[model samples]
Target chain A: MQENILTLRDIVVEFDGERILDKINLSIRDNEFVTLLGPSGCGKTTTLRIIAGFVEPNAGEVLFEGQKINGVPPHMRQVNTVFQRYALFPHLDVFENVAFGLRIKKTPKDELNRRVMEMLELVDLKGFEKRSVQSLSGGQQQRVAIARAVVGKPRMLLLDEPLAALDLKLRKEMQLELKNIQQSLGITFVFVTHDQEEALSMSDTVVVMQDGVIQQIGTPEDIYNEPANAFVADFIGDSNILDGIMKRDFLVSFEGQECACLDRDFAPNERVDVVIRPEDVDIVPTQLGIFTGTVESSLFKGVHYEIVVDVSGYKWYIHTTDNVEIGAQVGLKFGPEDLHIMHKMFDGTTNVLQGEVVGEDEIEFLGVRFTRENLGLPVGAPVRLTFSPYDIIVAPEEDRDATVYVESVIYKGRFSELIVWKDETQLILRTQRDEQVATDIGVDFNFDHIKIEPLGEKADA
Target chain B: MKSKVPAYPYFGWMAVFTIIPMLFVLYFAFIGDDGQFTLDGFRRLADPYMIAIFLKSLWLALLTTIICLLIAYPMAYILSRMKLNTQRTMMLLVMLPMWMNFLLRIYAWMMLLENNGLINKLLGFIGLGPFQLIGTTGAILAGMAYNFLPFMVLPIYSVMTKIDGSLIEASQDLGCNFFGVLRRILLPLSFPGVITGITMVFVPAASTFVISQRLGGGELMIGDVIEMYFVGAEPNFNTGASISLVLMLVILIGMGIMNLFDKDEMEGMLI
Candidate 1:
């Protein structure tokens, strides 16, 4: 394995009291292409700036070749950046722009000319050196910016969405060209982009970030095949995420059917988030599959048909070359290897459920009634109820508002966490005493803890 | 045809206010006082006294323009980098003096520059002599620079603010220090604004008679000579028109030289 050329330790950056990077730690290997991938406002650009020394993190240290360079200026750092807009000097010609760094270093005339001409040829701009930057096309300017940054022969190159301003065909062409250049030069390239396909195609390692936190880091194949969490699974590609109960080793149950999986090391009957790629599912006859559902919509998306099936109330996206008609009954089938189970991100504290107002002060959900003051909602109006786990009271008696079956009880540091089911709805709560799995229990809600919000356009007035 | 309609009123106003007056100047420049066409007025401009006055006006204007440029470029660069709200507030302060009457502002400067004025009083308190200040060439130059400083600053600030900030970062990324960035990027990019500022300040400073009269205490300039010939105690419209024609030619020649630096930008400014 190659050695790590750059490392970021607990890097934190804040702007106007808003944390843009939260304790981000990463390592880039020598001659590696690492991509920071996320949507806009996800701090990918800020992370690039931190490495380039254009932005100083509020805390933590940036290590380059085992040296701490916290306050080193950008000019002194052995790293160069190609800005987002290809910020070529408007007043300088292409040759002069590429020669700027060399001229600053006071290189001899013959050597400077030879090196500049070589760089221009590398970017395929052989005879265009004398043209002013303002007169060049966007892709040509992008080439000039690349040539200029790399002409200095820095240890690493940082590209901030260098192809973002080009057209689709041009961007595709540049993406391949950039990858080729990085390989030929043998320089570490740290790229930042919001385009998932671009990141997946160009990088040796993909670091997925969201909301100032690094979600996962692995090779492109590892990140795509074995995502760390639900966010990573959903962000990397089209996926169907569903709530499931891990019955035991190699067995899970969801959508009223039991299926085998490859995940283990969970408490028996534990709640887990199940991810299935759209391309992994195969449509089968209704009576010969694990589950059946009505097709909600089918879109012919180029290479495959994107079919959305309504399994109970949840929509499962399936990509298959076989075309399925909308509103037709269909059965989905997938092997055990296709199922990826992950620990749920939340601690199951907050429960969001859809309900209807039965009266001015009464709401109905999971066949249970709750009363409040000043609901102001008319009868039969749709609403949503959100309550915390602490609001649920589990008791041994069967006289409560709803009867539930205790599915699991796992030991938490402060208390035991319980997952109970009332009909088709799952409720998670904390209890002081251990509860036996598969035992009958009664549950009630604390009316004061539930927050009600009206649903749909009917409440707009 | 429709777009040209709005310009007709402006053309009519120019004919009445500008073109006709210039035609009168041209007519009187070549004609004698007896209304016969002659070169007597042009011949009088060769007098050594009038030539000296012209030279003095040119020298004072050049000095004032140089001083204004030196002070305004840095001020404009700093102001452009300030926060948007602070930039607005600072620009308002820079423009505030123009709101008061021009003559009133010059008189205020006179009171501060006189022998026993506020400035000399402070110098006296600091154990310095009350030197001669008000009736010297320095006073006239000071007044001209003070009045035209905002003109120099406004254009440069407007230009500098439009510069993309990433260009500066790119320079640094390519190993440019602070002074290197300023010299290679900021200076070249702000050239159009500097040219505009020079033209604005120099043209007005070269033609003003009031500052020399109030502050120079009898130091005569070309403007004062033109005034004496046209509207002063001894009025001679012919001689005044010829001097005005000559001054206009000199200023045009200077601007033509300046325009050679950046022709495209100059054309943009002209239209």
Candidate 2:
């Protein structure tokens, strides 16, 4: 492995007693372009500020080049920042703004002029030496901010959504320019942005984050093709993730069909999630397709047509060059390699069962007996049993002996949530569907996902 | 009514009060006591005593303006950086004294600085001799600084608060210490406020006869001399008006230089 340039170890941060980043650990290699992609209020900017030493994390160490720099001020660190607003000094001209850091170091006048002019030329602002920073356009000001940051030759550069303020065209142009600058300088760039297109196109590595935790970290292709979980699959790009069961070593069943896949390392009947990219699905003739559906909507997206195909009440977004007329029946075919399997974040079992303590480590519920690690109680003691929602797998009406009545089915943009009632208890599970409310559906889940506790201690409360 | 109705009253007020009074001053400056148009009043400006009074008034005004700026700039800087709620409370306290009559506030200061007054009595309790605290140039300077300080502070505070905080952070990121940021960013950005504050304080301090008469113990400034010409045993309105016109020209020229000094790319963004 290449040498690591920076490492953040167990970094915890809180604002006003609310935890923002919980034990975040990240490492960046030398000369790597890493993008932290997340939504707003996800602590991406806070992480960048912690690296810049503008903010002090309540706990944890920030190591730069194997040296702890917890209390080091920003100027003393070998890192510079290009802020979100392009915080260029309005009082200074372009040349002077770039020359500010060099002047502070007390470099010789001739050398300072040469370096400042060279940096200005790098950013395509060679003749803007005398132009005040306020007179420049948003793109030009961003260039000035970049030039000002890189003129010091810091080991790492931190940019906090620097392209967000620019128009689309300018933002695209600057993204490429910034990537090229980072490569030529051979310095690590920790870029923070909510724009996934920029992250996918510009950076070598993408760190997908949600809330305060990093959901996935991998190369761009790894993050895009093989997302770690549903959150990663939903955030990185357009994906169709549905509930699946690994029927055997190489076969998976989803949408009432068993298909061959390339994933393994699960029990014979283990439940999992399946993510398929929009570009991976091919539109074929209705007879040759594996799953046939009607094209509900078709939008021309410049490069390709984004078609939403409704396959048995499940909407699958497919990007295809073949134009299918709206309301026309179509067929979709995806290869076995296209189906990516992810470990479920939560075991989707929401079962609440009354259990009787049979032994020191065993509990009996629903005429079934199971052993637990910490179910320490006397025999015949009453207990409450529950499970995670992610582990629940929904099957066709004919697949199971017991059926659950759907209480309500609400469709979020990327997926749907089904609150099913069984035995007078509500179990919330996620599926890729437009499943209607008040329907009966068969549900099955893994036995290992179950949790049991004494009746006196309420599980949820 | 037409849109011009409200403006008509203001126009009448301006003509009757401002324009006519200014025209009368000009007329009196150019006319002799015998009712003949002459330059005799202007020539009287060459008198040594009149010139001395004029110089004294200019010096005292300059001193007062410099003192007010020295005290107000730091206070304004501190106030501007405070949270808005605290700043509002502090600003109210700073402006509370201005709501009262100016003469009454001046009299309160006079009582505090009197020889046998509150301050000296408190000092005497500590076995210190009763110092002659009043009837000095320092006393008049103190009064001017105390009276005009808010004028100097408010403008600077307003400008300082409006400065984008990111600019200062950017300066520090560029390796400027606190003092360096102050010199390079804060001071230059607030130069317009400094100019306005100087004009506001100096214009009044330069022409004040009351401060000199009450605090300096009968010292005669140019305003006192102008008053003497207007209300002395033999009043000379011509000389008084001439003196006023000269002082006005001097202030205008000073302001012109200050404007030149403030002209930069940032000036257009300010007032």
Candidate 3:
């Protein structure tokens, strides 16, 4: 509901012939603290640079209060950046550094002194006027950087992970201090960082991005509660997302059982994804629950116990305050409203169907036979199956011939996703903590989870 | 401590080669041949001819140092900002002439500056007059600047390369134009290097006798006066030692003034 201060439309940037930012469109409102949250190489810093006019986008329009600023240099912009490394002038004292911009404008000496002293006090760096920049600690240097950038009274500020170099405690302290400063100054801040906790705790609007594309843009609560896709759900916090079939308005199927969900508005028997937060799952007695599993791991995570239960081949992560023993039988319970459903996205991983076709409507891939639609191909011909990563479940390794090697595992929050290598292609699968990297694991799937297609010339059909 | 013993060799070398020779100079300058101390050697420096040669030497050295700095500062600035590969190649080119024999290099300059030499031949081909450039203060000044220009360039280039790139960018971001950045950031940060370069060029240029002998013709410098006392027809060790001591004192004072400008703590040595 606030007035937009800056808007970027269709921004594209490339480095060394590789696309770093692709058609990024964003709008920052006045006096709002917007944080661009993403992992490294996600082009978050590039986006901040483009807004500050430090970098030019190959094609885009940067509008500042409805005025184009594409050709404006960094010094000419109404925005200033607190660079990640602080970039303080080593030869200058703290006072001179803070008064640099004012001196450049030929401000009177008395006025410059007052303004610099005011900024130094604002950043809690009083009495540091005569101290050289090189003698300050990392936290003090950060304060000097903030003072220098803000003393100019620019309309907007851009910070490219300014707290990234501080220790954890100092970083936490600076996060709250920076937020308070922004609020007091009423300057619209566009902050860039890879730390999700920093973004969610300090920002008014968190723009979650991945691989140069924005996944979702919302308030912190909106981003935390209702993530738009699997990537967003996996990135923001811990969630167990699995492939499900939305049978109807209030029904979905997963793990060979029908479950209830609040999400709806999908075609009958449409492939979808269901996400349930770890904190939402309640631990019940094994006999009194809908599904039972043994607790494979229990880790003390300060406020709660992060317990992983193995239900057949599926690992369900549950966050509970109660202590549970490992290898004990337990049950996971969640209400219908706890589930979130989203459309499936295929990330271009192929499956090799090496089955001896028994009949016209039956096919096999990864040692699992399925009754599928007619392929209209010869019985002995080879066929390939395509499936989304959301459908693949990462499990413990097996010494069987129908297995692939787990090359790597990346722990997002609750569930860890594995990169498995089968033949020469790599496939990503999200699973539990039962598997290690470089171990051969059996690739398992249910009959209803896969789709069949003809090979070679008839592939598009 | 055991670590202090390794420095004994350096102390011994300093005593034998530097300290003792300096003591002998002082002893010879003050004593007559009768083993008695007198002020005669010091009074020899008050001679008007010797005073004129000393003043001329000081003037020429000052000219050479200024010329070298004027040419070297810009060259070093450009070289230091060049790409690493290009800098190495250009640096090799700058140092190539120094690898040759110093006397041979001076002689090469003599052949080019002499009457009807290679340079005059080229000038005559273009109808310019064969000027008397071989035995003038201008020719000696040119030779000294050429010989010591690398000493000026290397130190300034070393310091210029150490100037942080971010400081320049920060100045620009703080609304500094190119000239403003140079004045506020670049010049002050590299002041130590400039001082070192000035000392490096001026000291050797002020005390050189070989270049004066080859190019000064009849006009004598203080170095020529000292050489005449020690190794020329007169061979007066006392007067020669006194003149050399005075020259050393003058160069030391010049270095002390230069060191004052190098107040910023920096490792000013090139190697």
Candidate 4:
């Protein structure tokens, strides 16, 4: 078993009687790189501060080297923190700043001078000993902050979004440099960041949190490839959900279009959603295609063309190499192995509409809703809409009374993300170039496999 | 960065206001009773009593500066750390009574310090001690310290508030404990304010009236001597004016040393 360098057990912190961290449990192995990733107010920063002894948890234990270290003041803890603001001393020069921790510990003068110089050189700021702190740039000031903390050679380092203030390019460079520095020193690091890419790139283990609770903890690839829930899956990457009703052992049908997926076993005839990625939907030539459609829109996406084809009466976004012009007819093809089926997250009975085109951006089908956005469909064009059993979203059961309407569409070179509204809830779906789903064709769901969070609803779909 | 002064670039401006006045004083300083150019006015300052008053004035100013500092250092530190609202309220409270009039404050003190006054009434009721709150060098010192303490404290507090608090933390992180941090970081960083406060305190303490007259009773202070020369048994206008001129010269010399100490602090603040 790996020895835990700094261990936190069921740490609960409450400020003003409101829980910020509700029973958080985390452990760091010796010399390991650990990152806490989450949105703002997710307790990641609070946890880092707890370990650094900057904040005292209301309950539970924090152990350093097997000793319960609760209530130890920040200065006395065998830990150093690099605050988000780079809390460097303004009055002191670089030499004095780095030597600060050493001097506090009363390390001998010769030893102090030697260690300070070595550390400054390590941060590549060797000749800045006599320069005033205010004279340095942001990046250099950040280095000085790092040197100030590490010069003490603490057992663990707590970084609270240290590169958060730097620009994107600087942030990336500093991220690599910080990671390399951690590797060379072989010291335990507990880093906090909201940037998903930063966490994935630098951490040995990634801990994702939300609402002060741990969402998932695993290696980066594991967390990315196998999400614990739909939220984790969607949050980590772009996902397309197609709603369908299960028909066979591993098959599902979406608006009469049959598809197959490899996923958890489900009840035969059970309602479910099939999750598929855009890259998974392969496009072939018209003569060899599985399904047929006419090109509604084709967008060049540098490496690939995002094509929207009108299949039957439905619009399907397809990633293809061939650039089919608008109004040109083409064939669509997909296989059974490309779908990832998951259980339906809601019961949608109000918004299943089957209709004909009425107007450009506005559709008319009784009181059922439509959007003037993303709907570029001509007034008379017929479209047989086909959603991968994955992308059809059912409003959460609690918002049964609420309804979704189309709001807007954003065009990314290869595909466009549709902004849809359900009552007051908003969702952005990265769909492909299409002859808009004429707000007139009127949106209707034949299958109810996919589900989503709606207005005034709780829990992930 | 120092601009060349070009041997008094503002000499013409000074000549218009300062040198013209100095020329008049100089002319008066040299004219004797015989109505001829002589050193009679300057010679009057050489008298033994005049010399005593000069020494007394210097010592009194020095004493007031020291006393103001002793009372102000902690007050300034505490005030700087206080919340803005609290500091402002306390300042108003301290200065409200002051706006009434310096002479009024002194007379009120006289009322309290008299043999049968409010202080004695309180002391007699306590039945413990009959302390003489007035009519001595101690009383004069107390009066000067009380009246001048705010001037000393305000400048220091303003400077203290401006000095970055992180610098002290930096010092502590560098291993200097509380006392050493204050001495090395806070004091030096705020030295200019301290110099200004000291100058402000000493200047008025050396020349203020009423406080000495009422509190010191009959003390032989320089202020008292100046008043005597102006309105005494043998009123000597020439000697009195000469004495005032000498006091002004002494103040100038004191200010020169003060500016020398403050140059670096002034530069630091500018940066």
**If scored against the real structure, what TM-score would every candidate get?**
0.83, 0.78, 0.77, 0.66
Off by over 4 Å in 4: A9-22, A40-47, A58-60, A209-214, A226-461, B1-100, B107-127, B136-142, B162-177, B180-185, B218-241, B244-271
- Counting clashing residue pairs in each candidate, in order, gives 1, 11, 0, 21
Tens-place lDDT digits, model 2, residues A48-104: 989888889999999988999999887678888898888776667788889988988
Give DockQ: model 1.
0.39
- Model 3 chain A lDDT-worst window of ten: A346-355
Sort all candidates by lDDT, best to worst: 1, 2, 3, 4
- State the TM-score for model 2: 0.78
Give the Cα error of residue A114 in candidate 4, in Å. 2.2
**What C-alpha lDDT, on a 0 to 100 scale, does residue B122 get in candidate 1?**
97
- After superposing candidate 2 on the true structure, give the runs of residues whose Cα lies further than 4 Å from its correct spot: A244-272, A284-291, A343-461, B1-17, B32-53, B82-89, B115-132, B215-221, B224-236, B264-271
Candidate 1 residue-wise lDDT, A1-461, digit = tens: 88889999999999997678999999999999999987677789999999888999999989999999999998999999999999888777899999999998999999999999999999999999878887889999999999999998999999999988899999999999999999999999999988888999999999998767898999999999999977688778878877789999999997678999998998888888788999999999998767799998999999999998888767788999999888999888999999999887654557888999998799999988888888888899999899988888886675777788765554432355677777778888877876665466787778798988999856647
Across all candidates, the chain A TM-score values are: 0.78, 0.79, 0.80, 0.66
What fraction of the real A-B contacts shows up in model 3?
0.34
DockQ comparison, 1 vs 2, better candidate: 1
Q: By TM-score, how accurate is candidate 4?
A: 0.66
Interface RMSD of each: 4.0, 2.8, 4.6, 4.1
State each model's CA lDDT, in order: 0.88, 0.84, 0.82, 0.71
Q: What is the lDDT of candidate 2?
A: 0.84
